[model samples]
Target chain A: MNYPNGKKTNNKPVTNRKPKQTPNFSNRGMTLEEDINQSNQAYLSSGRAVIHKKPTPVQIVNVDYPKRSAAVIKEAYFKQASTTDYNGIYRGKYIDFEAKETRNKTSFPLANIHEHQVEHMKKVCEQDGVCFAILRFSKLEETYFFPAKKLFQHWDRQNNGGRKSIPYQTIQQEGHFIPLQYHIRIDYLSIIDEMYF
Target chain B: MNYPNGKKTNNKPVTNRKPKQTPNFSNRGMTLEEDINQSNQAYLSSGRAVIHKKPTPVQIVNVDYPKRSAAVIKEAYFKQASTTDYNGIYRGKYIDFEAKETRNKTSFPLANIHEHQVEHMKKVCEQDGVCFAILRFSKLEETYFFPAKKLFQHWDRQNNGGRKSIPYQTIQQEGHFIPLQYHIRIDYLSIIDEMYF
Candidate 1:
């Protein structure tokens, strides 16, 4: 027997596959957002820092208030965020960053970021906030704390006809590698402490 | 003629009344959100600080993408925010605050706030962020910057069977009055400058 995609029937169809429900303990299927959020929760619980990912921006066009139930948004659109994703206070220092996960193993593309977000980061940097990007290379299973100052150099260079993506080697050199941990999955705050504190 | 409410027709029916679109150059009808947003824009343009009101939280359940148009959120619901409405970096300090407008002449009711917001504020304060509440007494045309520490006192007192509202007189005594300016309408940062910076 053969599958629709011409593979042998021994391999199940991709659509028929479901995530295993067994109680296995590993961060194999988690996204970067989930990892950072869990890490933030750990930090918050331990009084290490107070950080939060801002909610996804949405533009509501219509809403219906049923008699007693909560108001339901019937029509809406996702909005382009005017700022970075995560921001909070850490030991009295303003912390701000956008998190991005790219499947590409060779380079982190600048297209992953928006222009106004970059402008917002620039303003945050001017205000002396510890602003940076949390870049996760999923294929390589590596994450880095890329500072806004270093990112600005690359952003400006790209606008001036330079490479559109930061070379993986360049990120390895300019950005601090964020190691995965047992409790705090992506321990980016450790990097912040070593660099800013 | 007589209006449906039985008032004399010399006055236009209340339901039919519309705000004059004559672009009257005045801040007479602006809400607290509008005033603060404009003030934030002014602050951003003048290189003073980077502050922004976080977008309203929404939980999207379903979305539809047409052939060419943008994705449309077909089902969603408003979510209770986990943090303050406004937060940013100002003078190298993490500025966190929630803005509220009340028409009551005697006091600002504690019911206007949520328990989780207080919890979030406590965490921000623990991190030494400059956290506060921007209270606007619309009826009195007065705005005040009430520090988070002072707010915590009233909150605790209320939880312990004290007054459920902070009396207007008490606010007048403890909170710093935020003067309305042409550019920075709320002018809460000026209070932060004096108190924190």
Candidate 2:
């Protein structure tokens, strides 16, 4: 088919481009973000864990009070996150981490992180808090739980003239890869129990 | 003055109008929010505190990718926070609180708080973490650290046919009033140490 812009169009090709329906293969279905969010809900509902996604930052500009009991915000801006994405207390020690998923097949780039976040994690580490990063390789369908120390090692590697990213083999060698499951999804704290507790 | 449209041009006086400069008052010269934020920075810089303000929530709709490295949000909505403005770990306990400033000369209004936040605080309390409200009566130039238990008492009073609002006298009577300071601004941990530690 051809459009007014004179470019050929075909829905069949675009539809065929879609990956397998299985979440394990496709980046869309049961994404890590959605699964982790569900896991958090399950944790809270079952009293198994108390964790939550912090609210996104909004710079509220105006509010319209159409009714006495309700105020509607008119404008706002998204503020950059100053700390890690997730945090909570588990088995007494404070838990903090940033979860990242990459489509790259070769190496996980360090550019995904912010300097202030690195410094924040370092501070959390100093306070004896459990801190780390959870990396998911969507292309490989693999998830790895890496300690803050290891992340820092890779984080500092960029400054010391090391590679700007960690290779897949390096993560597979040093990191504890988590097994995906039907229930208790992510199941990262199970690894936390073995490694930390 | 009457406008050409015959609208009275009335400037309706607003109620419970808090002062424009709520972050600074002469009695302490610094509001508790400023103090805690500064203290959080000090803690972060000196490797002593890891607490931080979570990202402000923004309901993002459109994004403009001026460059691949930067994504600028174009449209969004502001979400009311489910929890307090800040939370983190100090000495192995989760620190959580909602900081507010009131100008009332006699009592603080309950309207400053939301129902969901109270529920969230209850959960924080159940987890044995420190939860409280740092209320600053800017006009009175006073800051008080009221425990979650105490706040819950008054919060529940609303359902028990008790006063919905807490009186200034009652706060001074039951809450641990924080001493104003020059350097260790809003030294509330001192109160925490006496009550909790």
Candidate 3:
């Protein structure tokens, strides 16, 4: 259809023009990241668990201090992280792990993980810390909790001519898969209880 | 003695050019922060321990990922952290704690710590993790590891009309005071082996 100004318009009514992306503030809806972050915060606030995501590594070269309370990080470069994504105390044990999301339907590719992260996980396990990776397939809307040991086995086999990814069937068979609930977004510890404890 | 500007009558001046202000960098080749960073890295690299100073918490407001590997953190703000400075793995146990430096000779004022950090330490201890604080006296160039159990007692007693800060005498008597050595740099794990393990 043409408007008076001769601009063509789709006759269909425009109820939803698309949502503007919001920042960390929860004003907008929450994503999986936000849900886990809130759950972690709830854990901390209630003295249940003390877990936190290490901030994304950034090599801050220049900082502008317009005000003492607020320093603007300027001219910063991203740095490769040397450790896992999340770590903290849970039920008298140290918990450390990485979280990844894949859209693939068949399997989780090993390329999603980095060499340093694997090494970090190995060290954490050796140090008697509970280490693992949380894999979420958004397409499947399913999450799986695979202990670092399993991931290590798969990682090592990749070097020995095995597939460079963990097949979904193998993961379902060997991994302690976690179910997502509304309140507990990731709800990983539940699986840990059944698997480890 | 008078020295002419153009004519250096005397090769040696009575008052040598005010000895170049010992550069902040020269007086100490590396800042205390740098030294601690290097020590922590060595700990992580050698698999002796895994300790890291949490990067300053940044609230990422915007990002420009012009390339796949280059997700530049464009605008961010530094947020005050609620927990301690450093934490990691040591001796098959989860180690979590903070580091503080003070120039005060009489006492390391409790004001150096926040209420939230003390609470975090307590939670870490309850989880059966190793939690402590590394105190450094910049004036004396000394470092000490004060266990969380002892720290919690002092922290709690403050609510019952006790001293706010643990005095240096008490720290020396109760805490495992780590002696500064040339090669060891902030050798804390040795004390851990002797005291805890």
**All DockQ scores:** 0.66, 0.23, 0.37
lDDT of 3 by residue, B77-164 (tens): 7876777777788876777878887888878888888888987788788778788888766665556678888888888888688887
lDDT measured at residue A175 in model 2 versus the true structure, 0 to 100: 73
Docking class of 2: incorrect
**Tens-digit lDDT string for candidate 3 (A80-179):** 8888878888887788889887889999999999999998899888888889988766666656678899999999999799998999888777676554
For TM-score, the strongest prediction is 1
- Tens digit of per-residue lDDT, candidate 1, span B1-197: 43335543232221221212112223579888999999999999998999998989999899999999999999999999989999999889999999999999999999999999999999999999999998988877777788899999999999999999999988878887765545466677777766664
Candidate 2 residue pairs that clash: A56-B56, A56-B57, A57-B55, A57-B56, A57-B57, A58-B56, A58-B57, B43-B49
Question: Which regions of candidate 2 fall more than 4 Å away from where they truly are?
Answer: A1-28, A58-79, B1-32, B66-72
What would the TM-scores of all predictions be? 0.87, 0.78, 0.79
True contacts kept of 1: 0.93
Interface RMSD of 1: 0.6
Task: Tell me the deviation in Å of residue B142 in model 1.
Answer: 0.7
A104 in model 2: Cα distance from truth in Å? Answer: 2.2
Candidate 1 lDDT: 0.84
The residue-by-residue lDDT of candidate 2 on B161-180, one tens digit each, is 88978999888777877655
Residue-level lDDT of model 1, residues A50-104, one tens digit each, is 9999988999999999998999999999999999999999999999999999999
How would the docking of model 3 be graded? acceptable
lDDT of 2 at A33: 75
